[model samples]
Target: MWELQEVPGRSKILIHTANYSADVQGCIGIGSNLAPGGWWVTQSRKAMQQLRELLPPEFDLTITHYVPEYP
Candidate 1:
């Protein structure tokens, strides 16, 4: 499973497991799956590792929703 951590900055965002956009909840989710349900991914840890490697020592992440919200 992917772990979500809060990064301090303009906003506190999450870094976690999400294969599809629907799985996201104001937090980031990374997974191999291109579809929805359970945020299931083949290699979750490896994906997280790759992300860590690609980013700088310290970085800020922002997550935005593609869908519209209704109150």
Candidate 2:
């Protein structure tokens, strides 16, 4: 799911997250305050912490943090 996104000025990598609560799945977007393009993803808090560590020390991001969007 993470590898699907392709945007310019963005890094070429993927991250995955899971949320199976027998109800719904959650997702969030993130970015680098250190980079130009913000990051986009769906992941757990621990996963988020992993991202924070993986990302540069000055990156910024946005997260849905709770509910996943459905279309």
Candidate 3:
């Protein structure tokens, strides 16, 4: 998940996705693979749960939008 600070109330906006785009409006997608149409995420819940456990309650999350290449 990603977050942006410096806003008015300093609220922590989450960047997570549900099963379909219709379920979440303009929200970021999370999963191991893109769905068939490439508009949805395949394993969003699993990905989110894993992320949630790893993150601390209050902390800064920097989003670089970087994708690592594998050998």
Candidate 4:
């Protein structure tokens, strides 16, 4: 249920974790941004882990910090 996006003006990485709500918010729009329906969902923690491991090297992505106090 996690998501990530590389906004044009952003310099750091962004990672969305399913551990919280809104993890998939606005995520469906990514399909229109990337390709013709490439967005998919992951239900397993292992799958999420793989994504976490593999995504950074593929792009200049930044991991957004989730401050415990905020949520």
Q: What tens digits encode model 1's per-residue C-alpha lDDT throughout 3-46?
A: 33554452545566555556666656765444444535555556
Total residue pair clashes for candidate 1: 3
Per-model RMSD to reference: 6.7, 14.7, 5.0, 12.7
Clash totals, every prediction: 3, 13, 0, 3
| Alpha-carbon RMSD, candidate 1 | 6.7
Per-model TM-score versus the true fold: 0.44, 0.24, 0.53, 0.28
List candidate 2 segments past 4 Å from native. 1-43, 57-71
Judged by lDDT against the true structure, how good is candidate 2? 0.43
Candidate 4 TM-score, true structure as reference: 0.28
- For model 3, residues 1-71, the per-residue Cα lDDT tens digits are 56556655646555775777776565466676677856666888798888778877667655566887969
Best by TM-score: 3
TM value for model 1: 0.44
Per-residue accuracy of model 4 over 49-69 as CA lDDT, tens digit each: 666666664555454757566
For lDDT, the strongest prediction is 3
Cα deviation in Å at residue 40, candidate 1?
A: 2.7
lDDT of 2 at 37: 46
Q: Give the clashing residue pairs of candidate 3, or none.
A: none
